[model samples]
Target: MGADRVGGVRRPVRAVAYAASGVLLLAGCASMPDSGDLRDVESTPRQDSQLRVFAMPPREDAPPAEIVQGFLEALTSDDPQYATARQYLTGTASGHWRPEQSTTVLAGGPDIQVDRTTGHDSGDDYAFTLTGTKVARVDAQQSYTPMVGGYSQPVHLTRDKKSGQWRIDVLPQGVVMGQSDFQRNYTSVNKYYFASDTWANSVTSATAVADPVFVRRRVDAMTQVVRSLLSGPTRWLESAVSSSFPAGTALRRGVASLAPDDQNRLTVPLNGKASGVGREKCREMATQLLFTLQNLTPTVDTVTLQRTDGGTLCSLKEDQTETVATRGSVKQPDYLYFVDDKRRLVRIADGGTAAVAEPVPGALGEGVQKLSAAAVSWDEHTAAGVGYDGKSLFVGSLVAGGALDAPVLVSQGKAEGDRLTAPSWDARGDLWVADRDPARPRLVLLEQGEGEPLDVRVPGLKGRVDAVRVAADGVRIALVVKAENGSKSLLIGRIERDEKAGDRPVVSVLELRSAAPELEDVTAMSWAGDSRLVVAGREEGGVQTMRYVQVDGSTPEGPPPAALTGVQSIAATEDEQLPLVAYSSEDGIVQLPSGAQWQKVTKDGLAPVYPG
Candidate 1:
């Protein structure tokens, strides 16, 4: 045997002090026991505290090329009305330039090339070609749309002998900003939209979807958000959502100016066209404006809509228009459930009514052993769980002794490492799961537990499926797929049901598209509204973070409502007002109400979930 493996023991020596003899002695002993790495502490990460504001670019005489570069850089600054940046433009062009028409966000600084073919003399003109990667587009209404392509901005400059300065004579209608400045100077905002089915009688019951757009944080954000709302949803979500603004509807003037009245209510002056809308429609329009503006500021308690011709259309108080749809379902769930440290399914009522998450009454609630992941049904009458062993899946009622006689579904994993992800319930009462077995990665659907499990084939998918969440409409599915590159991504696919496969409709993935190309590793996700999803993922080489993203792969501009550190799982109801719940290793179960910080709801919780 080798000396290390034999009976011989290694030792470390230490120095010892002998006060009696006034001398130091060396001592030898066995090696000290090895200690493990230190455990990490739990706390919210420090937020960015540095103040950020836009500054005006310096006004100085310079060459035509230099002036063009300076003017381009100035457009990124937060100068009020872009006054300083306009200095590089001729007097006529400066007044005509409309930066609000569009904002082109580029991936990097523009590569500019000035053609000096013409002699540099007074009244001589030079053309500059600017090229860059366009990442996003902010339209006149301030709606943000992600685009992937190259863009060229050509501008003409003229030399002014009087000032010995080069000024821009002709240019594009909008401005361009580098990615860094675009993120800090602009913010994502949500404009309220109602379901397309909304009618006079269904207005009270209709749900609202939040159409996210990017707007200048320091500019008139409230006005921009409202104007975008009036313009309707983005093209990606136009098919799924609608605006109450009637056809050919427009502000009384070009853009309405909003001011607060003595009662602290916003008075909006629209053009005569607004008066053409009926009283009920006008009230609904005001409600939409109220909801959109409230997210920016709370000073305005009501909104008064009037025509530029001095005629009042309608006025609505914020509190009086509470029935408007913006988030989740009409009736919010009362409690959110999750598995505790003991692997017992428990629930915490809203408002902290329940000090502890008592075991749910049903068999899976308290009696089920070694439960790994669980999801509550839409009706809240049943739940589906994955066994801790990662093989068996159980579905049962929420009442006492309501579990099925045996596990309804069983997955085959080559090793203990293979596991089944959490189950998600769709509005049609279907339970969806992905068996993450390397040998057989597939999506399985259980139709309300009334029939056998069906394997849904995702045609053209080259990676293994991790998790899936079906939308309320039952036609779309949000999937987290592990790519061949060893990273996970979020993809949205249409669920096509073919009637040719016997009595039950056969489901298959079709027209699959990336939902969040920005996220490199998608760990968890949930549907937040009609056309958006709250995703938990990490950027390339970045820590995991949560944010709202459109189904079409566009990120919203607003920060995540809460900080999620070491969060294992998260869940939220369809209703926007319902508190968001998550399970963190350090904080246990945490809940966050609208506009509130995360609050610990319980200790030692995991896989928090809400009713479908």
Candidate 2:
């Protein structure tokens, strides 16, 4: 026999022996004594990585406050089905309550106080108020949105007429827990969907956009991700991206468990809605599954789709996925481009050992037209540069004899600092730039980097646009906006295009949300991965630092990159394996390679950037 402590109670582990077989079976068991002096057991906190927590059921004749506390603690336990949590509710409430409806994350533990206004001191009825500061919310769709303000919900308990016991009769629809517990239980995962506007002759050529959502980390994560993918893109991205799965598609009835086989092959069983699709469409569906699962479970290298009748609809291998849909802006960049001391656009191959910088092949590189900043297209065949005056924008080819086109776009701001910002290119080959003219601030987009620039309507903009960077998928864009108080912040917005408007579609940026709400000043930022960005900013009354923030406004798990001083601009690629490039007033152009310290690339270079 051995003893172990759980929930601050000592329980014995016994070995039972079968006389006939002469075999010993070790088992750990714990039970509450039916008739004993009751004592409170402190709920174990999930602060340690290796600790497993087991929840206790409702005690006999527990007080209303104790009952509420027990239920709340049980909500944070690792129980897969939350069976122990349901034990604290009444029979009717247990049947009607839906814990999976949603989750409310508070800044800390909720405060439980008896509601005096109810005045139900009759011993048969009681009411309590659960209050806390709102932090965030995870909806049924697994979407996590950061929120602010107060949270006050009422919980009612009634005495059982026969059992003479107290049970919760009225409560909120979903569970509520502290922010620490929420972080411990849930994780973010990206679901892949093809860009609706990028459909070409070859399905593999379409671009894949990442829609991030949160799910329970220890629960049926694989199944949850698959269901989320089948449900289609979230509401914010529905207009911009398309899923290969057909409408009303779902998992086959009675199929609950999903896992990969020994050979790293995942077989997904779908309903009849997917049975009618042809081989090409089915392969596209499989491609989405392959990429979506690979993010969560890297071991899954192949995906095979099955119809309702258990017949194979289609199968796609990992190597074939790229042909179906390209991951966001993952093409390797040939050179790191920046502006040099002479105002000419120059490049260094892979931040080379010799640190030699050479001028690019274009009019802007010839030093005839000095440039303040520049952006290279993903294909590396074209480049856009903002003039030294910050009022004119020029586009030229990378070919040796390529000529510089006249200023395609110009700003009217009186001051140079208020004029056009450096341009950015999307994977679709379109160019985006923000005109910071205070009198006429607007976002401009060019179709294939030419023709008349379209004014992108931003419905809820409350500040002046200072800088802009568009993600490769073309469905999202990042901006640095200056407020009236002379502070700058980072924001992420969704790009929606109305193709039915006319020959040229109407473009709009919707739902601009803070990407770095904690930072009071955001100097520079760039896309570092599918849903992550490397941000350079500082909090109020704090020193400058660089960190990674998700589009949903949540910080990543690991520690931020090593601090860099005076980062005027920064650059990163969707491929995280590549080194990070940045321009600092203190150190000039520097690159941080994997497992190494920052090394100077050139003292004359500025505005370092990789291809979008």
Candidate 3:
């Protein structure tokens, strides 16, 4: 969410001022207008009242495309010249650099090549898709200065009628880089999953990808329904994450259902006429995430359910069973998932590492908060995770905020190199998890008031446990283990608890198996239904994801018989419908309603979420 002032994006006081601080996004997919027919298009009508505040027609003098090009040239100009660009500027106080910010705008012949241009943002904004091709002029040799990894994709630009002139409002390329880098930097931002393609060099970064190109596609698609909210046809600047999905992909419509198993696991699905490629892509990404991410290596493991006595967590405990894990790769809690009755997340935040993203204004405001406490901190690594018990709600996130009112415990485990990798919750009040810090040794179990004696020494679980989840009805348990080379894997099976292990239970693990594909830094887990589960995991080098669904639809099989791809973190409604999976990578939550259609639920941006 942007802020309290955020609404379907209203108009501006000045043409240029309208976009002040209004992010200019580009996914390297430059969709600009062709030079021929720039002025003929008409502005789209506004849907929401506020979005049309500064709504006005473009000056009769200049074409929409021409106005946008003016700003584009000013940005790349070698010599200082704000003349054309200033004409189209909104002229508001903002962070957007002005002509004065430039020493000289490049003039004469430059490296900009217009590719494709079209009526964008509900026809209210004209756009151009151009490439900053490093073309060698007759007198000069040209070499491409790689953007990010390399090969700058086309840039998408948007033009709007701010007042007398058509002002450039959105920059798809700039927005693309800005948002992607922001996400990459946070390293903590997590989402359900999305489906996709691999036409070229790009791995497509797993699923469909939220790059600029993908975002614009979503924006345009959104216009089909809410045509009025955009007086200027609201531009899809950067982040694909939005509060709502295009009406076509919304979850509230019908067909799909949600179910929660005894262990508090959730299940839901998207049904209808979804393309095989799309579903397949989503599954592929999910599979990668579930099968990878956690650097799990186990020595001794087991799954067992214990009845509770009284407190928030069950009185049961695990005696030393598996060898202590080496290290669990849980960087953020959101990466990990657990089946819950309501699917309550402590706080849903948007952030990334400072190394990549721009400074998040009071980043604290964007994260998950339980009991009304805001947990946001860039000084340390953060994780977003959920805890469900069919009844109670206990969601946890790695924020600098401490509930007990103590100094925020920065990642103590990580700083000392005793990296606390994966972290997750279980069906009951208990959480199947493991975080680490040197001075502290052994695989320990924890909750707010749980007694110390109940904490068990999971044998073979030497260093740490990356990610862990208890299966349906608490019949099975899954854990990501780290091994000698630091390689991680999933260890799933049955566990038996011992009362003699001192009020707590001694542990026994049976039928342990590793995921088909090895995982690196395991994240989260949710129940799919009919006995299957969807786990969210991330590999060291690959994209984040959720995969692995149950087959028999009755038992928690633990590790899956095969690896699933293009999916991450399952939040199904149980056995009824397929599942309502959160596809963060694709910038929304997807579902299979009834084998007939697909629904995408998102919260990328809306008004600011005023904290409690």
Q: State, as a TM-score between 0 and 1, how close model 2 is to the true structure.
A: 0.91
Which ranges of candidate 3 are over 4 A from the true structure? 1-411, 415-428, 438-443, 447-449, 461-463, 507-511, 515-525, 535-568, 576-578, 586-598, 605-612
Error of 2 at 6 (Å): 26
- Report the number of the highest-TM-score candidate: 2
lDDT of 3 by residue, 1-612 (tens): 110111121111112111345543322121233332322111122122112112122234455554544444333221223343445555441135333211210112222333333435464554444332221110001001111222233333343445444555544322111222111111110111222111221232222211111111111222211112111111221121111122232222342333334643222222221112243333332232221111011111221211122111111111211111101111222221221112323232321101111212222223322221111111123322321111112223334443322212223343523533223332223333444445553333443213341344454554355545544323345666666566556655444445465755664444454432434655545444323455566755875655563321111223332233444444432333333344444444444444433344343321111110
TM-scores for candidates 1 onward, in order: 0.70, 0.91, 0.30
Per-residue lDDT of 1-612 in model 2, one digit per residue for the tens?
221111222222223344356565432332222331112222223444433445677877866666666677778766777898898789999999998889998888666666677756788877777778888888888777778899888888888999888788899988898887787677889999988888852334888899998888767789999999999888877888899899999999999889999999999999999889998898889989988898899999999999998999999999998777788774777888999999999888864444688899978789989999999999999999999999999999998988998999999999999999989998878899999998999999998899999999989998988888899887899999999998999999999888789999899999998888779999999998899999998887887889999898877677787889899999888888889888899999888887888888888879888886
Which has the better TM-score: candidate 2, or candidate 3? 2
Full-model lDDT for every candidate: 0.70, 0.82, 0.30
**lDDT, candidate 1, 1-612, per-residue tens:** 110111122222222333245454432321111221111111112122132233234245555555665566567554658887787789999889998889887786565654444444445676766677888778876666667899876778887778766689889889886676577567776677765544432535455555667777756667766667767777655665567677655566665455577887887777555667888788778877877787667687899887778778888997767655434444467678888888878887873336777788788777446787888887788888888877888887889866555777877886654668888886557889888888887898888854688999798897988887876655568888888897988888866666578898788877577888788998778887656788888987887788888765666545775768886677865667777777777888788888888988887878888876
Q: Which ranking of candidates, highest lDDT first?
A: 2, 1, 3
